[model samples]
Target: MIRLSNSVVLQDEELDITAIRAQGAGGQHVNKTSTAIHLRFNIQQSSLPEHYKARLLAATHHLITEDGVIIIKSQSYRSQQMNKDAAISRLVTLIRELTREEKNRKSTKPTRKSVERRLDNKNKHSIVKTLRSKVRRFFE
Candidate 1:
């Protein structure tokens, strides 16, 4: 079983791990060895709370497939075991992120002093523009 957090635990069978060849830079070694791990977990099918499932699905549209599977590929490590562990850690991290509750923001109106300051600035600007206008003098 994978323990996501203090409150959430997922069955071991829920994760599907596949070993695929790592991509980039390593040349033949990268092409030959399947060190990279591809991990897929079905969020909708898991035993997570309804709210957690909903939040995860909503937050990760790119990571989750159309069929509702969350896919994570881990290949930074050279060994297959390391890659596999990395994949599991990534999964745990992603699920753990869902556990946090966003603090509610209170809507606030502009302060009276701020409004007054803004009007003062505008009035000063208008006075400066009036002073810059062409002036005329009459002669008898």
Candidate 2:
């Protein structure tokens, strides 16, 4: 079981790990060994809370498949074990992010002083424009 938080625990069976060839660096070793890890978890099938699932889907649309599986690939490490661990760590991090509640933004109106200052600036700009205009000599 993977403990995401104090309340959230993920079952081991939920995660599907596959080993694939790592891309970039290591020359011959990279071409031969299947060191990269591909971790797939079905978000809709998981025991996670409905709200968390919804937020996870919304936040991680790129990671999710059309069939509702979350795909995470890791090739940073040389060994398959290291890549697997890295992938799982990423999954936990993503889950934690989804679970954390966003702080509600307080709706605030512009202060009276700020509004007055803005209007004052506009009036000053208008006055400056008026002075720059070519005055027509009506007597001419």
Candidate 3:
């Protein structure tokens, strides 16, 4: 079982894990051994809560496909077990992130002191710019 939070846990059967050959350079051992792990979890068919499933399905992550399946590939580890663990951990993180609630932002007005300071700075900058203009001498 993979624990997502205090109340959320995912069963092993929910995940479809497979071993595939690792890509890129790793010498001859890489070609002979399947060290990569591919994990697939269907949000619609899983035992997760309705809200969690809904949020997961609505997520726009690259790992989540249009069919409501999350696919994670882990190949950074040298061992298949490590890769599998990494993939599962990544899945847990993704679910947690997608289901987490964000606090609504409250609009706030700037403080009077801050606004005054900003206007002062703007006036200083304007004065400096105006000073840079070519001076006109009536006698010349």
- TM-score, prediction 2: 0.81
> Can you give the TM-score per candidate against the true fold?
0.77, 0.81, 0.83
Model 3 agreement with the true structure over 1-140: per-residue lDDT tens digits: 98898888899999999999998889867778999999999999999999999888887999999999999999998989999989999999899999999999999999999999999999999999999999988895
Clashing pairs in 3: none
Greater-TM-score candidate between 1 and 3: 3
Error of 3 at 28 (Å): 5.5
lDDT of each: 0.86, 0.87, 0.93
lDDT of 1 by residue, 30-80 (tens): 667899999999989899999888888777557678777889999898999
Report per-prediction Cα RMSD to one decimal. 2.8, 2.4, 2.4
Give the worst 10-residue stretch by lDDT in candidate 1.
59-68
- For residues 52-120, could you state the per-residue lDDT of candidate 2 as single tens digits? 888777774677777778899999988789899899999998778766897999999999999999999
Off by over 4 Å in 1: 27-32, 96-100, 136-140
Residue 65 of model 3: what lDDT? 96
